[model samples]
Structure formats: structure tokens, C-alpha cells
Target: MPVRSPSLVELNAFLAVARAGSFRQAAQELHVTQAAVSRAVLRLEQELGQAVLARSAGGVSLTPAGTQLRQLVEKPVAALQAAAVRMRKTPERLRLRLSVVTSLGALWLMPRLEAFHLLHPEVEIEFRQYHHDEDFTRDDIDLWIAIKRSAPQRWPRHIAAQYLIGREVVAVCTHERARTAQTAPLLLAQPLLYHSNFPDNWALWAQAQGAKLPLQRKGAGFDLVMNLIEAARSGMGVAIVQQCLAEADLASGRLVIPVPGSASTGRGYFLCRRRAQDAHPAAELFAQWLMQQAGAPPTV
Candidate 1:
């Protein structure tokens, strides 16, 4: 018997689940509910009369049939999505989708967006949070504010990349935590916490400071820099944080910059988008406003 065609929603849900390996994560990726994703996958399984995914305590894995289906439909679905993007009629209202790195979005931009809304009440911004490891080239998103580690020049050539803030980092901890740093080499013996994305941050900062920091795998690590900041502010440990994001905390006395010299991690946050002509007008407006907000010069 021929494999019956699955609904587009079912196929999309299955693909998201397969890529993420968890229905909850897939729902997040698809911006849908976990139950909705589960239902779609179940409907797809029933339509196929076979299990496509193997769910376990660890997570989810693709079955043989799932693997085959993914190999067949992934490119087609991507093309379909791209085609839909191209086919969308430009809305009369100036609206655009902007994907922002999670930490920056929450700590940096979220506070400053009211100004943008006031400046361009005609423009509407749809916000999405992006992760470090995920694909960044979705056509549906009009702009991306992302962190680039090195050679920011080559990222997305032929596109606009305005480096908002140079990756200037500082060692920060609550004021009370600094008093207990008797351990030699500065904060090494403390309950050192870090954002998981930059596991070598402490080592890098130490290296930049002309000190040796042994590889450390101990203590709490968080995915979001905001959480790392919270943990540090709660006196959990010293965290190497991006200075731009930690400015408010440092100013408000929530977090204290304990380290003497700030280290440049060679990472920078960039405001990126398609070419001006090809980009949404609202995205361009937001991008320009954002550059001004960061006090970074606009790029052509």
C-alpha cells in the first residue's frame, strides 16, 4: 500500500519534533502547544499505520520510517515554506518578524522597545527568540539580532550586519560575594557559574588577565545569560558577563564589577537583516532605531 499523504501541519510537527527530539521543544520551535504537536504527530502516525518516533525517558528518536520520511520531506517542506514567504502579499501595516538572541532580547532590547514603538507606531514588530545552535536562515523572519564570535565581517555576506556592541566582558558578582573571595587567582575557588554557551569564559577571562585558569566543569551552568546574572546576583558565584547586558545591574548595585580589567571575548552582537531593498521597511526602521539605541554607528 502506498504511504498516504500526511497533512502539512502533521508533517511540519513531525519534522520539528524529529529535529528537536522532544515534543515540548518542537512545540517551542514551532511556536505551538505541546499537545498540538503531540496530536499532529499522532495523527500522522495513525495515517501511516506505523510508529515514526521512539519516545523514551531520555527523549525522542526517529524510527526507521521516520528517518526515511524526514529524508524525503525535509527539503520539500523547506521549499514550500520559502515559497510561501515569497508569495505573501506585503501587508499594508508595516510589520516584520525579528528573531533575537534570547539573552539580549530579554535583558537588552525588551527594556528599550517601548521607545521604538513610540517612534514608529506605524511599524509592528513580531519577536522571536533564537538559540545559538539553531538554523538562522528562516525566510519568515525579517531580521536577526545575533551574536557572532569571530570574523563578524563574513557572517551573512551581502546582508546588513551592524555590530551593536563589541563583546566587552567583565567579571561580576554580588557585592557580598566579593568579600569572600580569599581563594588565590581570584574567584576560581568560588562557586564559579557560567552560561553554558561559553563554558570556557572563566578560562578565557583568566587567560586575558595573564593568569592561568584550569578547566573547570563544576557548579551551575545556565543556558540564558539572564539566569547566570540572577545566580551571580543571588551570590551564587562570580560570572563573566557581557558588559552591555550587565550595565543596568551594575549601575543599580544589583551586580558589582569585581574584576579590574574587562576582557574582549572577540564576540559582538550584530543587528542583521536582508538588503534594504529586499528587506521589510519596518525591519529596516527597527534596525536603524536599534543601532541608535545601542549607540553603534549604522552600517550600509
Candidate 2:
């Protein structure tokens, strides 16, 4: 006779028995009788034409075939269980979860969020800051804002992205420093503040201006652009930052561009989201609003 396939009930019973090492214990765990658990496991063994468990006075133990099956199904079963738990915990309200760089969130998005709220009061928003690299597919992120030299070549195939705005890097410092320095070389001589993520920003800006910055100079380094801007504003040092991030400070006279020209990094920010059969209404609304704010064409 040909071997038959085991049913889900039988497989679950076998797994329970293998884990507990006893029909009585497995039955207790499953809230079923010992005879029912034994019958289920026996049915599975008969279908597969294998003695899946060994019975002895000491206790029950899985045979080689049972061990192999357990190993194959454990991860998939765990994943299903986890997915079910997530579905149960998800809220009913429309929520958009966005992951963004710390500086952009603080300087640009936060200031404009209230307007979005007023317009779409029923929609909820959650912002998460990722200071380091992240796997967008595995995280519970609904969308992401990424800054790159150009469109990323190695992004996951499941994600769709649209260009938002090109970044213009400019050197900025307090008004006092601006008054003291009349030339690019003088500005470069001050303690240069550095953004940890874009450590070569100043050097790149200098190279764009047909000048070379000394790499040997020591400066205060901050992981977040907002902190670097604050350091520059406090007169600690001159910092090379994205022009968009310091627009308010520059307009308010708290900071000044020490250099006359800004360097185009040939880079821009991209709005990214997973490709799905249908877009979430809240996410779509926010994405469109973001594009409008960035001066980009609205996403369809």
C-alpha cells in the first residue's frame, strides 16, 4: 500500500507528543484525553508508514523520522503563530507608521505634522527614527524616507520608491563666526563640526569649491544632524549641513552660511513603501502631503 499524507491534527498531535515525551503530558497540554492523543499520533504513523515514536517504561521518545519532520515544520509553525499574534494585536484605527532619519524628522516633518493632523484628524501617525541601517522588509515599518547619493540600486524588489527632493549641502556657523571670517579658507580654519553619518560632507564641499580641507583637524562629532546644527549655532564650530535642515535658523539669524556657494551632492531623499495590491488610505494621504511639501509632483 502507498503511504498517505498526515493530517494537520495528526501532525500537531505528533509534535505535542514529541515535545512532552509522553501521551499523558501531551494530552494535558492540549486539553484532550491521553487516548485521543495516542490515537492521533498512531494515525500519523500509519499514514506515513513509519514508527514515529518509541514507547518504553521510561517514557516516549521520537524516532529518527519524527525528529526529521519536527525539524522541518518547527520554524514555519512558529512563524504562523507569530503572524497570528500580530494580526490580533493590530489596532482598528487607520495608522501610518513611518521610519525617518532623526534630523529630517526633527527639522522638517515635525513642524508640518500639525497641519496634516488638522486636515485628516481621523488618521493617526507614528514616527520612528532609525540612526543606522535597517531592513525595511523585516521591520514593522509602513514607510521609510531614505537619503542617498542617487536612487538605491540594491533596494528590496518588493519596495517602490519616488524621488522627493535633492539635498544642497552648505557650510553654516554662528553670526559671530561669519563676521570674523571673510573667506572660505578662514571658515575652514575654525573647529569643524562633523555629522557622524556624513563624515566627508565638509571635504566634499571643499572639493566642489576647488579646495582641499585638512583631514587631520579634530572636531566634535554628532550622530544626528540636529545636534550638529545646535553645536554650530552655539559657536562650538562650523558645520556642513543640508540647507533644508538649517533653513529656519538661517532665516532667524541664529546661523549664517559662512561659505558663499553650496555643493550639490547629486543626492536626494526618496519616499519608499512596500508594494501591495492596494495602498492604505492614511499612508497614501501622508505620502502625497510629503511630496507636495518637498515640492515634488504628487504621487498617483
Candidate 3:
């Protein structure tokens, strides 16, 4: 059976006016006068045998019939826009989307990412530096490198997790403080600083060492771990920092590791993603390259 239809132009005009809730606004969008938009709506209403809009003090509103029609059109319109965008995008290049904590992004991943790119020149890697948290499903992240003290509660479907790196806390201080703290009580007495995220890290380490001192009363705390390390390096106070983050300072003789014993925090860096068994071509290549670079175990 043949179906009769209203003009696409008139339907589009009706949609614009309905969305904007004003003839003037619709006219601006359609590049026509307000009277032209009014005419188009009236023509559409006549063809559909229904009133699509109601004029009121608030300017305009969709009638019940218009609301239903608008709902039907909205998704298709959005889909068409999306399709057009995808079609316009060049297919020759592959885009890899990744997200990671700022600390890791700066200290660890950024330096190493170039190697991955060198291997996969055709793949255009896009990195999103995430500060707090990430929604694996909603955020268009292909690879997620998260640094944390504990593992996540859940993982998305097709996502696989692997331990990327391990770092342990060490007492770091300037050369002068290192020279001064040669004994036990002095170790506990030095205004020990803390990282905000690990508020009780100093206390936990002290307790682990069986050195019962006034750890809580000791010092100031900084939010960023790097800032805490910088403070320690400048001789502000001794800080328990991850070895990986402090290795450069320690090696340069600017900061010294005061305590040899380490408190097992069971915290480390991890790589997680949606597809467990499968990996994007670029991701797979990078993963293999990373394991080689880090000397990760065969199982990892």
C-alpha cells in the first residue's frame, strides 16, 4: 500500500520550532522568517490531521501528538548525525583511546608511550588523563592504566587485568637529614610527613617495624605524592614514598632511603580493559612490548 507523507522540509521546520519552543528561534535555525516557520507548522498540522503545537505566554509547546512524533524523530536524527560524522572520518588511521591516573601518566606512562607509538606508527593513540575515577562502560577508553592501593571490585565484560608494576615505600630525606638520622629514636622523631591519600601510611610502617612512637602527632600532609617527595628532597621531612617514584631522587644523592625495611601495602599499578581475551591490535602490540620492557612474568 502507498503511504502519503508531509514534506520533509515542513517536518524539519516543525521539529526546529518544537525543539526551540519559539517561532523566532526556529526561524533563525531554518534561515527563514517567523511567519514562514508558522506556515510550515500549519501545513504539517493540516497533513497530519493534528495540532502539533500550542501557543502560550511561554512562547510555544508540543501538543500530545507532537510529543509522540518528536520522540520518534529524535533518535533517527541523532543516528543520522553520528553516521555522517563516522563517514567523514578517514578510515586509514586507527585511533586508540586510553585513560590513566595523572601521576602514572606523567611519571611512568608518558615516557614509555613513545616506544609503543614507534612500534605502531599507523595507530593514532589518544590519551585521556583521568584524575579521580573512570566509568569503563561510558567513557570511550580502550586502555585503562590505574594506580591504586587495592584492586577494583568489578571489571567490565571482555576486560582483562594484569599487574603492570610494583612499588614499595621507603623513608626519603635530604642528604643532611640522612646524615643526621643514623639511629632509631631519631628516625621516629624527625617530623615525618604523609601523603593525604595514605594518611596512616607512616603509622602503619612504624607499627610494622615494632617502633611505637607518636606517629600521628608528627607532621604535615600533602595531597600529591610527588609533592610529598619534593618536600622530603628539600629536607622538609622524611616521607614514605614508592620506590619507583623516588628512584631518580635517591640515585642523584639528593634523597636517601633511611629505613631498609618495607611495609607490604599490597598496592601496585594495574592495566585493565573491557575485553579480557581479546585486545585491540595496537593494544596487543603495546602489551607485548610493555611486558618485554618491564620484564613481566610469562603468565602476565
Q: Evaluated with lDDT, which candidate comes out highest?
A: 1
Worst 10 residues of 1 by lDDT: 275-284
Candidate 1, 1-300: lDDT as tens digits = 975689899999999788667897677656678999999999999999999999899999999999999989976876575445445587356787888888788788887888777766667788866756634566777888888865433665335566788577778898888777534375676777887877767777777777767555356899888889988888888888887788778878888766577777777798766542352556645655675678742111
lDDT of 3: 0.69
Per-residue C-alpha lDDT of model 2 across residues 1-300, encoded as one tens digit per residue = 964657767877888788657887677656678999999988888878889899999999988998898888755654554344335565345788888866677787777788778756656788766645666664667888877644234666566666676467898999888877557777777888987866777887888887768767767899878889999989998888887788778878899897788887766677877654143666756775676688732111
Alpha-carbon local distance difference test for all models: 0.75, 0.75, 0.69
- How do all models score by TM-score? 0.61, 0.62, 0.60
- The pairs that clash in candidate 2 are none
Q: How far out, in Å, is residue 246 in model 3? A: 1.5
Candidate 3 residue 29 C-alpha distance from true site, Å: 48
Off by over 4 Å in 1: 1-92, 129-131, 134-136, 149-154, 182-184, 214-218, 276-279, 296-300
Over 1-300, each residue of candidate 3 has an lDDT whose tens digit, in order, gives 765777767777888787557887677656678899899889989989989899888689999999998878755654453344335557345677778777656655666677766655666878876746665554577777766555345544444556676545667788788777655457878888887887767766777777766735677799887788888977887887766666566767788777677665666676776542232555544554664555532120
* Model 1, C-alpha of 92: deviation from truth (Å): 6.3
Query: For every candidate structure, what is the RMSD over all alpha carbons to the true structure, in angstroms?
Result: 15.7, 17.0, 17.6
Ranking by lDDT: 1, 2, 3
Query: By descending TM-score, how would the candidates be arranged?
Result: 2, 1, 3
- Which residue runs does candidate 3 get wrong by more than 4 Å? 1-94, 149-158, 276-279, 296-300
- What range of 10 consecutive residues in model 3 has the weakest lDDT sum? 291-300
